[model samples]
Target: MTATCTWRIWGLEASLTVTDPHRLGEARSIVDTIVADVDRACSRSRPDAELYGRSIRRGRPTRISPALCTLVDAALDAARASDGAVDPTVGRALVSLGRNRHLATESGRPEQAAHADGTLHVGPADHTVIRRHGDMLVVPEGITLDLDATAKAVAADLAADVIADEIGCGVMVDLGGDIAARGETPVGGWQVTIDDGPDEPRTQIALQGDCAVATSSTLHPRWRHRGRSMHHIIDPATGLPAEERWRTVTVVAGRCVDANTVSTACIVKGAAGADWVAATGLPARLVAADRSIIGCNGWPAPDRLAA
Candidate 1:
């Protein structure tokens, strides 16, 4: 029998599942520890997080924890891989877009993302010195690192890997929509539903082996700033919310972080997203604002998916 648990974290849903019922609690513990570690180090919202406050001040040249450093590295890697379609320096841009304060009283929830001018000190991380490819990290002056695009997916990967290895069972970790799996595949594999919203078309698919899927959207976790809609995914080239060409994009990859990176980049790539992710050879599903589906790299035809 399988066991599962669900809770809320950082204002998003977090779920864990294991093939062995008895190991469920242990799996949760492993994920909890991983989440806490990441939250402590990478949360841009936390005043005391390693990437916040004085730790990121100009000319600080701080040496961050390996975990946070690695997350930043992954964000930078995604930026390069996506040709700046995904970037970490949008933290300052988000602040400029009115993310410096909590959401307006009507929302009653903490602010998540906003539009930006994309005025980032963009450069190679080469100046920061990554010795031996280690997690050592340094943020350049005039640049504020934002790991919102990668940290959660990386944490899900880490938690799933650890839980499966230590518990000796198949495991799945879903941090919001960034999902990961490891160890054996259960009967019928891990069935996932791609349901972007009430108005969006939906489908179900099964993942096999050690793999992951991520869904990056223009709707979920969105907000209104100055009476205009805004989303979390930032297109660094424009320093603005990605145009809603595809209302949501889902990608399947060997690792959750990689899948999320590509999916988010697709959102930023807009009209060219399908071609870009298709070139990567990973399967993906992109739903347009009009609810039409665009499949790439062997995603089943729209007629084959659940309604």
Candidate 2:
């Protein structure tokens, strides 16, 4: 008995698949609760969000809720894994580049692309100084935190875990494009359609065992800033959106958080991304701006996924 449920949450589409059809309702409630909790704790655009308020009043140590703590830790891990390519300390950088608010509603607006005035200052990973001990987190007086890269994926992982344990059945959770699954898998596993971009052809993959998949793209969440096209994937070093190289990158990893980390970092890494993704030994698909594609670490060949 298998069933699926899809809903809108936190400005993204969320879907839950359960092996036991009778447990679908229970699974939906679990995922909804998890997403709401995560949004309240860590949403970058929510003024009332815990992360937003804390970013405003930094300097002293603040005790965070378990959910926020988990997200912060995940962000830190992503930064460390990618050697700061996926820094969470870029919150101020994002705001300076006109990303302080939600992009889903304001995308493609020049007003949403305010010119950055000052130099974007973020030092090496060690000197950046975001310290965490248990649930306590401390940052520089003016440093803002943005965990958008990993937060949603972590939320999906949490939801999948809870649904599988509580219902004692196989479960899959997809928040936006970050996906995680556990327990039993369908005969061919979960079939996932990968969206390369508007101009590129989409492809499909199957997730077997306990694994996760995530994709980061410059094609979406885009806008015009100062008469130039911009996107949401900011490079911390420049405090600006990454330049066009690969339109999108998708990765498969043991956890959704990890997969998202690699995908986002690859976008920031630019031309060196291919080598970086290869080093990680994960299957990945990278689509160039011209719609040309690159496969790494054993991803399906272009002929196999061509539009």
Off by over 4 Å in 2: 54-56, 101-127, 196-198, 302-307
lDDT of 2 by residue, 1-307 (tens): 6798887766667788999999899888898788888889888767778876644354678888998888889999988999888988777666555666441121122323333543334332232588888888786665667888889999989999998888889998999889999999988778888974555757888888899999999988877655667788888777778877888899999899999999998989999998999999999998887878888888877566433
Candidate models: Cα lDDT each? 0.77, 0.80
lDDT per residue as tens, model 1, 1-307: 6788999998888899899998899899999999999999878677677776464444345666878776777877877778777777776556545564421121211333322643322232221322213543445455556788899999999999998888899998999888999998888888888876676788898889999999999887777766677888776765567788988899999999899989998988889898999999999999888878889898978666533
Candidate 1: where is the Cα deviation over 4 Å? Answer: 101-136, 302-307
In model 1, the Cα lDDT at residue 140 comes to 44
Top TM-score hit: 2
